[model samples]
Target: MPFVYMLQCADGSYYTGSTIDLERRLSEHQFGQGAVYTRDRRPVALVWHAEFDRIDEAFGWEKRIQGWSRAKKRLLIEGRYAELAGWSARQRACRERDG
Candidate 1:
């Protein structure tokens, strides 16, 4: 199975990626040998993850999640579906008002 994952960096920021080997990938991230973004932010912890049968599906969701707002991402990491909906609503309202 392919996995889509979110990592909470030591600096409290988040990173999203997809991989077929979650354990190995996470080990690399923790050891500062992962993506350049996570390399400097070593010792990251997995905050959220989902498994998919297809690499393409996992990769697509990884891309989509990376584009999300920080607040929404946090809601997802924390499994706060209610807060995510509210955040989405607020974002839409602000965009409509400004645009």
Candidate 2:
């Protein structure tokens, strides 16, 4: 199985990734051997993860989640799916108002 995982870095930033071996990847991140973005933001903790039957699905989800705002991501981390639908409207309105 493959997994899409979200890690909360020590700096309070999030790192999203897909991997076949979640344990090894997480260990690497904690030991400063992961992505450059994560290497500097060491001591990361896995805050969320979803298992998928296909690696492609996991990778695709990882890519999709990486583009989300911190607030949206936090909703996922907190398992607040009910807010996600309304959040899209709010996010779009905010973008339109300020962008």
Candidate 3:
């Protein structure tokens, strides 16, 4: 199965990616052998993950999650889909206020 995963970096930031082997990829990140983004922020924790039958689907989801705002991503990691709409509303308000 293909996997979409999120890691909490050592610096309290988040990273999202996908892989066919979650365990191996995670190991790589922890050991500073993975993506450069995660390499500098080693000792990451696997905060979220989802499995899919197709690699393409997993990759698509990875891209989607990577594009999310931090609040939206946190809602997803916490399994709080219902709260996302409220968060999105707040984001829109903030953006409107800023500009």
Candidate 4:
């Protein structure tokens, strides 16, 4: 099985990734061998994860979440799916306004 996971880094940032073995991957992250982005942010904690039947699905989801805003990601981690779309729309509106 494959899984999409999120880690809350020490600096209050989120890192999203996919792995076949969550435990092994998490251990690697904890040990500073997982990702370059996480290497310096050691001691990351698993904040959220979802299992998938296929590796591609998990990877796709990981990529998608990686592009999300921190607020949207937090919404997901908090299981507040109902608020995601509204936040996403607000984000887009802010971007459009800023541009």
- The order of the candidates by lDDT, greatest first, is 4, 2, 3, 1
lDDT of 3: 0.92
Better of 3 and 4 by lDDT: 4
Worst 10 residues of 4 by lDDT: 83-92
In the range 1-99, model 2's lDDT, one tens digit per residue, is: 899999999999999999999999999999999999999998899999999999999999999899888999999999998887646656689879997
Please identify model 2 stretches exceeding 4 Å from their true place.
Answer: 89-99
User: TM-score for every candidate vs. truth?
Assistant: 0.85, 0.88, 0.87, 0.89
Please give the distance, in angstroms, between residue 74's alpha carbon in candidate 4 and its true position after superposition: 0.4
Candidate 3 residues lying further than 4 Å off, grouped into runs, are 86-91, 94-99
Residue-pair clash count for candidate 2: 0
> Which scores higher on TM-score, 3 or 4?
4
TM match of model 4 to true structure: 0.89
Candidate 4 clashes between residue pairs 3 or more apart in a chain or in different chains: none
Q: Highest lDDT, which number?
A: 4
What TM-score does prediction 1 earn? Answer: 0.85
| Candidate 4 or 1, higher lDDT | 4
| Model 2 residue 76 distance off true place after TM-score fit, in angstroms | 0.1
Candidate lDDT values, in order = 0.91, 0.93, 0.92, 0.94
Residues 58-96 of candidate 4: C-alpha lDDT, one tens digit per residue: 999999998888989999999998878857766789979
